[model samples]
Target: MSTFSRLGGLLLAAALPLGAQAELPAERIEPSIHAELAAHTRHFAQQIYRVAGNVHSAVGWQLGNVVMIEAPEGLIIVDTGESVSESRKIMAEFRKLSDKPVKAVVYTHFHPDHINGVQAFVSREQVERGEVHIYAHETLLQNVVAQGALVGPILGVRSAYSFGSFLPASDQEGMNAGIGPLAKAEPSSFIAPTVTFGERLDTRIAGLDVQFLHVPSEAPDEIILYLPDNRVLISAEVDQGPTLPNIHTLRGTRFRDPVQWVESLDKLRAYRAEHMVPLHGRPVSGQDKVEEVLRMTRDGIAYIHDQTVRWMNKGLTPDELVEKVKLPPHLAGYTPYLREYYGTVKHSVRQIYNGYLGWFQGDPVALDPTPPRQQAERLIALAGGREKLLLEAGNAYLKGDYQWAAELAGYAIRVDHDDKLAREIKARSFRKLGYASMNINWRNWYLMSAMELEGKLDGDAIRQRSVEMREVFLSPDMVRSFTPQSFLQNWVTRIDPQKAGDLELTLGFSFPDVDEQWALEVRRGVAQLHKGIPEGTELRLSMDKRFMETLLTGEGGLVKGALLGDVKVEGNLLEIRRFLACFDFADEAFGLTLR
Candidate 1:
């Protein structure tokens, strides 16, 4: 039998119990508590109740629940659902309860799910009229603007895998599994916040004493609003039940401060609210329960932080720490809440260590690394022929030893991508690992990698659309960091920096409804990125941000397109050409280089 057939049969044999397959009521929320809340508030037009998300069972991406707090002023909405569509559905349900206008909207963070559906609640004109005040942290505007163009699109594509958006909706696949329902796509629209505050802001809206706390941990732009009168706390993404917080997201981004994250948790612990509502997942009530959950969460982060640092001090490698680290029994018991649905402990610990100590773990050998493919080929040659490796890999697969199978097959495929048998074995091994992972992010990563090997990668539409690079205003540090990744030294050598002597170039980049300008100075082979207009210099280049991204990625070229006027260059055109020449196209053939 084929490997797929055998794997399919094994999965079929492990099917869930008959009770698991039976679908619950269409509109019924799970864990029963939420359903009871919905039932209790069914008849009351202006009643407040907590809706449960997938809290007790699953983790990550599953929103908690929305607070239905109706007042004589109007229906004051806290957080919309996870997506624009989900938010629309939630608003529809709210309309069923009352015909009141959504007086105001408040977002906990800039995560797509939380703030993507403002149009559903109120029109732009209503918000403009000061009738509806969309409130968030002052930094929320910066976060939204930062992610508006390229970053947003890139994240949206990766999110498909992170959230299992394309997975088959089977009980064994995409069912609630505790984190709420999974779907392929969500209709979303970005709405900029109309009002923002720096620190703590208290105001009365819709008969509620809404106190906004600028909690800069989970997200620097996140705000946790407390309705003191109702004793309800709206925590954006900061306090997510008991799960290990994603200090550094795997799909990629800046290193989140673990210390700050813990401090923020401590702040929430002191709130003393009777009820807590999170952006995703279910609500937690009762003071003791809230404290217990908060403690578990705080301790979980502390455990990873303390243990990882302890190991780091002991000269332990990242790999060594991953194997040795374990949460205590008290923390471990919160498995339902502490599952690696988003961030795995192993990865989280690594990030914590990196954030504090930097990458080098006191090992000189780790200072610079050789490419993986080159090393893999050498290892394969040392292990005899490829066929021998394949045979051993097959044995491992049959024994259900996926880790060994993956390791062997990875080496085999790296040695030769045309090796069909090795690729097949690697793909199946990854699927098995994905199937066994409770951490949804890990599952998605493994599965996505496997799909690439099998040539079944999805979500290409978003990937194909090049984002306007200029729309994202990167800080000088951010731009410097991106230089090594975006442009290689070899490409840099191609450009004659000597020809572009102390040239100052200004480019006014604008997107539809978005505007920003970059002032660049090229001198002595260094390019400095700055904001605002440039001073006197050699040239000025004007183009849309999308076109700039395409040019940088080699999908389009500056000199070739400049003639067509797709890119316009004024002043010293030759100097601009010299600057372009300084960048070398990245060597795609150099597989497994330090990323």
Candidate 2:
């Protein structure tokens, strides 16, 4: 479980076509959509553009772009990249252009693609020594630490599916990840910021007049960098490259308020800079071109936001709004940037509906419906029989009604989870729908779900792969960025109630090297973490800082270390085992997909 599983390549080689009708019908892939995605290959090809003056953007090197602003004495970098390995390649090329030391590093947002490459530019020692300064929004640190918290496990799975991590690296399948090329690995290097600003900050970095504004868009802590004297605007994710902006991402995100995104775009437009550099795609020069892109990007966001609200106000359900709300003809074809390669109006409209009105759309019938499997069983009965229902599904698939066929197959599956025929029919429908999808996320999710349904992927294997993603995400450098307090705080949910519910115990921890003392108190099913050691404790254990780091990074095990004399123990060493036993490390049943 330490390496990413390439499940697509491991697919059963002798697997048969999903059903007897697999070759009966032609696919309905839109030629224009396919061509549009293909054309973006050129847009994201590896290259570095001299945006304007001393500002250069290295695009297509990783999922997020990196910008370098040169100064007479040093260089300023914004958004490192997805990983140390990927950024090292780009850093080599950047060095050929400038020989100055990196004076400061700034992050556009807290997304991994933008921050994981920090060590490639400068080390933590340099920052600690006051030689290099790291700049970011004040809220960025909290979000970065949250990556290892409760929701992290599931977020990793959803992100991998959206990024096509499990798909083959071929032109027909995983050609382009829509944002940038997928990284070979998710290795990360994180450093806490040295300088953080709240809403806005104006200062001089490397002798350039710099302004950072907290504009919430793609990410909560998103900040745009503007050089007042250089007249250059670095429009981070605020202007997500040449595609329909993902006002709402399929890979689940913080509440992305469409209106707030539009407002943030307005904030960028106020700069009136002559040059605009976006993190995902090419840079734009000239006031007219920059303004057009900014306006179109914001207008596209506003159109989706307004229209969804319009229909939602009419008592329309989310499904109904999906049918009713659409972009006007002008906006739909306005610019290539508005193309639905990354985000589609279909998904965007649904999120807006949920934001305004909750999951229940005033439908009392949905309050307490029959359980899923029972309802599906009744559906099979209503359709005369299982064979007849499966037959109807095959007929619909042959007629190119893939969605309806998939729905029917789903009911059949809900009746019996292991119906081979029903699974095959559903997998067939998913393959068709995947190839016909207009957005990258939709296409990838559909294709991945098909793989899961066809027995090409094993549940146990997928679960292990998802769990291994933690190693890449919480790399050694990332683990080092956490304070003992923050690191142990994420483990609060892992307390085993069955073991610790009736027991009351306090365990003291001392790290003499780091001069940090912490304690964990378990009382009646509740676990409390304290920054300082409690006054009285039943057991006390001291650990070297280096040994503690190894434990956090998964380099060693706690029980093994205690037995190996790597940990200092006092007051009944067996109590160490008792404390460790109170936590649950057993893997849960859910993983990448619930079905």
Candidate 3:
């Protein structure tokens, strides 16, 4: 049987009957609502759903939902599908409804899935030439560049694990991404917004009067749109799917202000939208239901945030508050929409605490606690070392006490990474834990951890491969804006001092296309940049700005460029090669669950 079947069987065996009076442990009980609703793709996938008057949504075509508003002149596209190919498919189906030219595009947020597919609807030249306009929050560009360019290498892999990026597109493993279907990992065709707004912007585009509200919810750069004519509200990530809002996502990011998130929900509620279209998932029609969902979502967030603060005032720690602050029975409605598919109550509670109180948990012991490996070693020693711990962990796994088994095996493996038996036991434990998890993100992470332990998943390989692809795919426009000094400073700080070995080299680069010139001087693992070529440059390299961009982007790579006549060298090739080799740029991947 497949792992999914085995897991489902195990879950069924462990879980109590629905008629039972007592509550099953959160770990054992599968969230029926999430499995039922998130997996209900047949109802809308590949269908142009008429959400409300003149509004249509193409759901399940990609990671992000595409909503089209038919206006007098053309269609106002909101949050294009995740990729150019994805948008092509979605828009093909969308065109069956209407073939109007896209007058404007509104980016709901800076998330790649929401904004990267702009090239599909309109050409970059049109957007650049002011023929077509794209609007987004003022901070969207900076936020996108920061997340996609600066920290993309790290975020890319973490996101891969969280979203089951590498997992096959099947219900047996990776099926749905809480908000939408599995994201296709294709090259993102990101077109920067031509217009930006702050706070709110009321504008008429495509002969449709719309109100854009800058509501920072899932992302600080997020926004929602309201069409007064249709009484429709396009809630971007705010209502991304029906799942409980991910106030805190597993992929690391800045802490989301629960207070601000709640306020954003309120702003949407004020619209009293008869038809509510989310950036993901299906839309909701009927003024009453929309109002109810809006209110319930707001209340849920407020309950978590307000109660977390209330308990914190009583000196309750985050851990304590997470357990104590659950939705009251009256407020915890039995709606599939309110279920924790992406975010759980405990995590939301903790995030609420973190938003107010930083990572310091007030315990000095925690402030200077023993390192994880050392603590594991000490624990293993106390428990009769690796063999004893592995044996106990194995016993626990056999008894279906996966949490305990994983805990014991974790300690044993941490103390001695070569403990093969412990690693196998821990992998089994995590597999069970993953199978039992209601949150898909947790399930993916747990299963990924199990795979990592078994050497099935190579996080390092993924990171390194991602680095190469990202380097080539990163926009040249963004890279060109980087000043020589800033670029050199960043590389210099990352240089390994011990790798210097008394080597000193200088290289000059001239880019005629952009009229930019810079020279690099390296000594003892330290590097400095000079504007224009310095008089005593040991070697000189000249190339078109586009060629330089390609070299930096790893297009043909440096060696290939030199051999292919893409780059010209005026000095010794060995010297240039040696100079390039001096910089240590090894890709390093960090452990997630293992640590």
Residue lDDT tens for model 3, 399-418: 78988988887886676665
Per-residue CA lDDT of model 2 for 70-122, tens digit only, reads: 97679999999987888999999999999999999998888888988889999
- The candidate maximizing lDDT is 2
In terms of TM-score, which candidate is strongest? 2
Span of 10 residues, lowest total lDDT, candidate 1: 24-33
Question: Whole-model Cα lDDT per candidate?
Answer: 0.58, 0.79, 0.73
The alpha-carbon lDDT assigned to residue 158 of candidate 2 equals 76
lDDT ranking from best candidate downward: 2, 3, 1
Q: Which ten residues in a row have the lowest lDDT in candidate 2?
A: 5-14
Angstrom error of the Cα, residue 377, model 3: value is 2.0
Residue runs of model 1 more than 4 Å from their true location after superposition: 1-68, 148-157, 169-174, 177-179, 458-518, 530-535, 538-595
> What is the alpha-carbon lDDT of model 2 when measured against the actual structure?
0.79
lDDT of 1 by residue, 7-38 (tens): 54433322322121222111210111123222
